[model samples]
Target: MNITYDWNKGVWSNLPLGVKVSKLHKFNALPVQFSGSYEYNFANAAVVPEWSVNLTVKLLFPM
Candidate 1:
């Protein structure tokens, strides 16, 4: 399974100083992997993106 998401904030400045870009992605596999991104403004030199990792746990049920 795979999933992706994004979010943006409203404009709060004439220079678009309050602009925000975010992204979240995930994939279901052995060890679940995920990544998160964050960026502001339109300057390629001022971009900030982050990544994350997650692991899936198995649960056992008893009858």
Candidate 2:
């Protein structure tokens, strides 16, 4: 997700787009992951906040 607006510092901004909810039901292999994120900020009447996280592990070549 991404939203933004800035008209002469009119204040508005946020971004949080993460996906990978346990990665259920793999088709070939490599099924395990997690994702996270958070962000926000404004101007003129400014406010600020931001955060992000990502975890992964994909090693599939054993059949």
Candidate 3:
């Protein structure tokens, strides 16, 4: 399992995106992740919240 925190105090602050944070876990060797973030449109003065879930599988073979 893994978790992360990201903060951008310069470039990203002026864009339509905000802080990006996510968490990842391994289930039976498959990777599953959940992410949530905030969006900001400075020009329009709007804020939006978003979240997502993703699952990934990996194939491995012995050499």
Candidate 4:
């Protein structure tokens, strides 16, 4: 799931909004797979960062 909104024309309370979510996991015999993401921002601007998180681990090699 993801949603984002951004504006840069003039002052409208510094309109910038963003949201993101992600998840993935697989384990049936331990091939290893995991994923995660989270992000949120509501800009008031000073260098743009409200909240952010991400994690991922995947190890599956079969050829």
The estimated TM-scores of all candidates read 0.21, 0.24, 0.42, 0.26
The RMSD (Cα, Å) of candidate 2 is 8.4
Model 1: per-residue Cα lDDT over 38-59, one tens digit each: 3233322223222223343333
lDDT per residue as tens, model 4, 39-61: 55555445455666767777775
Cα deviation of 23, candidate 3, in Å: 1.1
lDDT of 3 by residue, 1-63 (tens): 222222543232233445656676676766666666555444322222233233444343325
For model 3, give the 10-residue run with minimal summed lDDT: 43-52
Predictions ranked by TM-score, top down?
3, 4, 2, 1
Q: Against the hidden true structure, what lDDT does model 4 obtain?
A: 0.52
Q: Considering lDDT, which of the candidate structures 2 and 3 is the better prediction for this target?
A: 2
Query: Which residue pairs clash in candidate 4?
Result: none
Model 4 ranges off by over 4 Å: 1-28, 43-48, 51-53, 58-63
Residue 58 lDDT, candidate 4, scale 0-100: 72
Task: Flag clash pairs in model 2.
Answer: none
lDDT values, one for every candidate = 0.31, 0.45, 0.43, 0.52
Candidate ranking (lDDT, best to worst): 4, 2, 3, 1
Best by TM-score: 3
lDDT of 2 at 50: 57
lDDT of 2 by residue, 1-63 (tens): 455565666756553444434443455665534344443332222333454444555544455
